[model samples]
Target: MTKIKTHLSLAVAISGLAATPAMAQDTWEGMDTNSVRGEVQQRYDAALAATQDPAYISANDPRYIWASEAKAQCGIALGYLKSRTRDEVSLSKCRMAYDRMMDVPRPRPVIAATPPPAPVCNRELPGLIFFEFDSATPGPDAAEIVSYVTENAGPCNWSSFQVVGHTDRSGSNAYNLELSQRRADAVANLMTSRGIPQSALDTTASGEESPRVPTADGVRELQNRRVEILVNN
Candidate 1:
């Protein structure tokens, strides 16, 4: 696989400096067990009215699709509400719509795949390390990882490694990005203190914009907050 250079773009680098909290609630609502068809329809319409992006439309409106599916499922329950009631036909129709919509594939958000490991460095062995949340301090976990790089340094002909920090999609993009950069710098400092040459290390940060786990905003997935080391020989 081609070696990947791990570095955050300037936009991300700047954005990470300003960490902000996530919005408390999603604007779209009505996905409830007790929600009626009309309520679901209302929420869907509202969501559509709120968006101006063409790309948003091309990707089937998630709110409407979800509402439609909920209505269908509710129909099945409504059908069974009265075994001998007169609303059987209506209930069946609801179930049918739900089944059909469920069969339709919804558009999934696109995400970039993880890049391959960087080529071995010439002076220091190349390796990657992960850090805990909101902290630049390297815990015991990082020691073994650092050791691996040092052990293999000669054989791999590794010279230097770049530490890239990342955060989950929780706070404001700008803040998270800055935090990530700091985290990367912290890791780099640790390596240097442990006998790695200062010239053999570089650092960068990518705030919550680039996440390992594509969770919704403010979910705080640990996997998303981490650092990646890229070796350059």
Candidate 2:
């Protein structure tokens, strides 16, 4: 009889993270752990189907085992983050598990099968809108960009729209953070008003930490002060 190996359990990986009891249970509170686990099980099955190798689409294939485990953990980690339980330790463990799984050698294909075309998802709009110093108002070009997003997002049935704001390094860190957040909010508000649902939008401020170009402390860079829009389906 052939000995079958099972993928490492997510609980075992979580235990290795050395999570504090409070941190681990924070998001699980007020929720039925059994029910959530069942939901995750369904997602795991779907992911396995999505990642299964065409040549060996069976439960015994080590490739399917590896892909499903990595995907399940990654999905769980994202769920925790989305639930407002963001922790570096949990995220690091998930990433490591995925990397280690992908590092393994996959079986050579005995039969050639043309893989299905990848799904069309995620779009980065052309031409970012540069912002004036300390201003949240959209200029003429910025308005055009915003219009494109508004017209396309709902029709595309996008799952989420990310508005990331950045700023030049001319101001204090505190000031830049606030300015960047305001700019992101301005863009998000415009999109929501134009028909995009508020629930589908996320706003983040990068401040001076993520400049388009490296510059001195007091330098004003035009490209750095901008908002990036990403649509993910």
- TM-scores for the candidates: 0.45, 0.46
Q: Write the per-residue lDDT of candidate 2 for residues 1-233, one digit (tens) a residue.
A: 13122333433343345445543544434655455445444544444444534432333434544444445454544445445444444444444445455565655654666555332222534225567657877544556556656655554566687888889999899999999999899888878787778898889999999986678998876557888887755
Which ten residues in a row are the worst by lDDT in model 2? 1-10
Q: Model 1 reaches what TM-score against the true structure?
A: 0.45
| Candidate 2 error regions (>4 Å) | 1-122, 125-127
CA lDDT scores, all candidates in order: 0.51, 0.59
How many clashes (backbone N, Cα, C below 3 Å) per candidate? 23, 0
lDDT of 1 by residue, 155-196 (tens): 566677778888877778888888898888878877777777
Model 2: how far residue 220 lies from native, Å: 0.3
List ranges where model 1 is wrong by over 4 Å.
Answer: 1-126
